[model samples]
Target: MPRFQYRAADANHRIVKGQIEALHETDLVTQLDRLGLTLVRASVVTKHKRAVKSLTQQELINFLFQMEMLMRAGVPILTALGDMRDTAASTEAQHLSAGLYERIQSGETLAAAMDKYPGIFSEVVVNLVSSGEVTGNLPEVLRELVRALKWQHEIAAQTKKMLMYPAFAMTVIGIVVVFMMMYVVPQLTTFLLSMEQGVPIQTRALIWVSDLFLKYWWALIALPPLLIAGVVALAQANPGVRHFLHFLVLRIPLFGEVLKKIILARLTDTFALMYGTGIPVLDGLGHCRKVSGNLVIQDAIGRVIERIASGTSISSSFAAERLFPVLVIRMLQVGESSGALDESLKNVSYFYTREINESIGKAQAMIQPIITVAMGLILGWIMFAVLSPIYDSLSKMKT
Candidate 1:
């Protein structure tokens, strides 16, 4: 592609000059003519380095919402995209819209035009749109897409809500611990030394721990990231390690169950959506695997696909894997027997979504008290160790 500078005149003969990307000046002139303008002067402009761009989640959601609304208004797909481009907040989306508009004007289908901007639209989205174009159901597909995005956004917000307080509390507790060890402990230890008498075992232990921490405080702060990086490298280097780590995550006490539910919800929702769009079961499972975000789940889904290929019933395949919950498998069984597998999967997604929300609530209620108590105990011990000797020495002097 080449960049071209063109001077054009509208029907009123008002001159306009702009740089546009095209194959050549001739193409630029052709585009200008399509825009109902005549090109007075055209020359190729130098191409510069192109920057890669991506839309944020919120932006994409807004775009989808607007598209759904416009589509419901009975506007043509290209016209809707053009209207969206005019109101777009980002230059990247504007460029994408322009390209998409050009493609549609050139007789390319709207879905095919969107396919050129995979960064802005996912394969699932493009395919669904293509299905809509084929089935003459663009409004319905866009409605479903908007619902899907809203569901995802809700899940993400819930996840953030679950984490935000714990993260803030942990940081506060860490700062308090560091302050007691580094600044408070050493000043109080002098009295214990001057007394030359037996100190409580717990106090001595606390003092020694504080001294060690003070001496190597920097190492304490850096250790977490170092350990995490080392573990990540090990996991990457060895498949067994990676698998073990994944298994370990699923076995974690408080969070593993929540994580499992969340992942399952995402998988079921995506699978349902794809299935609803007329994609085959096996193909839906394959696509779901790509978006599952868990390698273990991906492998399990692949196995499920293989089993389905071998003529096993959907529910039987799922039950054999034992990866999904019994509720989900039962739903699949019912769906398969009833010949409404897509609706059943949708119900499964809804079930897991409700479960995820309840689990998050329970976990949030349990975690705050646990964190507060544990941190309080640690800080109280440090305070006792640092204050006891001072009080003891003062009492002796008064006696």
Candidate 2:
């Protein structure tokens, strides 16, 4: 289908300019007519494929929030979508709304409409919406999705805050080290050697490293990215490599623990939504396997699914896997026993969410000092190595 940018006239005779995808000019005209507008002119912008970008998390949140509020106000789904299509700020948002409106108008359910835009909607969101459609809880599901997307954005921002300063600080430190090794150290080494004095061991080591930097600066700069890209490619192509790497990643110290909590928080939150919306335990678990983005967690969820399929209760299945924290397992047991599994999973999600926030805060607070000390150590070493041999030469000359 071709997308057309059209100039149209609404009922009040106001000119509207927007883009829509359709088969041809006729289809574009029809789409405009359906939107209660008359098409004045439309030129085909692109043929066959949608070139729109995907929505960011914040955009997705706002979109869902609007939809939820409109639905709650008793607006029909199509009308709500049409309103979105007309008022959308970004071309991508307009395209999303137009694409969904077109699909829904063609007799597909809202979930089915959203499924076509996999770039915009995750399987989790699609699954929740589908469940909501069946259970007549679409508004509630949309509201939950809005909340979840917001939480995800918050967590992501916090994680970035924790890592960004250190990354930048290290990059600066790296440049300084390279400059010192390649230029400063070489000049001082020549002076020390020219004086015909014995050079210190540390200065000799520094000169050797400096020589390597001067000789292979390009290689030093390029090798890290090439190796990283190669490892990523290998991981993508080989499941075993990916699994092993993911397993190791989960073992990495403080960073690993925070990552694990992030995954588990999403998992428990999704389960809470699934359970609250009347999705089946086994089905929800099946969908949640990839939520963690870690093979180990996915494998664990897979086993939990199998246990549930084999007649184990959900909480027991989680416990048997030995994967969840004691608090989570206890909450699951309580919720399962009390016939309020969703509430229990929500508590787990909240616990992990709070933990992740605090961890990020603490990690950020510690990163500044650690980076400072690391840079200080590097500078201290360079200063000591440069001055020691030169000072020794002066003292011996006086003697």
Candidate 3:
């Protein structure tokens, strides 16, 4: 699709200028007319180029929060959209509001219009809005959407924080090791070799490693990033490979359990939100399968869906997979028997969220001391290797 920059006059003869995507200029003009805008000028812009970037999570949250407030205050949806379009602080927000307003004016539903911008509005969001539209509960749904987005942002922030220290520690350790092998050890080893005494095994081994590193310094510097890029590209290109990588992450010690809990927390949180918004259980599960972010979980959800479709109970289907914890399975069973699955899912979400927080805190506390001990060992080896021969020389002089 080609994008077009256009200036037009609305039904009230107010001038509006924005960009929209269409098949051609004619189609762009038609879309403008449908928005009740009289096209004054239009020019096709290049594909894949936009004047504005995508909206950030915070920006989207603000937009939804404002929209909810306006609707709750008795303002019409179109009026609220138009006001937001004009007053938006960011170009991304302005463009989104304008596009959505025009689409709604052209007789498209809000959810349908939002579906056109998958980058900004995820499938989960669009489905929730569609349900809200159907039920005339758009304001309430939007509030819940804001809460969900905020919770997601917080979880992401915490996860990043949890990983930051270990990543930084490892990177610093790598740099120190490279510096020692390339510069420090070589200098010290030359002096040690100048002595009459034979070098100890530790010193000899250290020298061998230094020589290897100095000889292949370029490869040492380049291989890590290249390897990481290759792995990421391969994962993206192959579903099986990607799934395996996700599975591998979940099996890792200490960190893997935290990652699994995070995924489950997100899944249950989203499930509760969608189900609370009047989406069917099966439909909610289907949407969750797409957004699970873990192939293993997705496959598990897919199997659950199939089981439900084949007349199996939801709780039984979940338990049959054996991927989820016993607590989650029990909660689902209780929800199913009591006919309050949404509330049960909310409890599940809360449980996992609390677990993730505690697990992350403990992991962080444990990692710092572990990293310190590892660094101490490496430094100790280098010192002992470099100093042992010197000690031997002193003993010879005394003899």
Per-residue C-alpha lDDT of model 2 across residues 28-86, encoded as one tens digit per residue: 78679978999998898877656456998888898999899999999999889878876
- Clashes, model 1: 0
Cα-based RMSD of candidate 2? 3.4
Q: Is candidate 1 or candidate 2 better by lDDT?
A: 2
Q: Which candidate number maximizes lDDT?
A: 3
Candidate 1 wrongly placed segments (more than 4 Å): 1-52, 105-109, 387-399
Off by over 4 Å in 2: 1-53, 397-399
Q: What's the distance in Å from true for residue 57, model 3? A: 1.1
Number of the candidate with higher TM-score, 2 or 3: 2
Clashing residue pairs, candidate 1?
none
Error of 3 at 89 (Å): 1.4
Q: Scored by Cα lDDT, where does model 2 land?
A: 0.87
**Candidate structures ordered by TM-score, highest first:** 2, 3, 1
| Model 1 Cα lDDT, one tens digit per residue, 1-399 | 357788999999999888876545665676687688899987777855344377787887787788889989988877787677656788776666667766787899978988877787888888888878888888888888888888988898998888898899999998988887787777777767667556877788978888889888889989999999999999999999998898888777768888888888988888888788787788778878887777788789899999999999999998998978787888999999999998998999999988998999999999899998989899888777767876776788889
lDDT: worst 10-residue window of model 1: 44-53
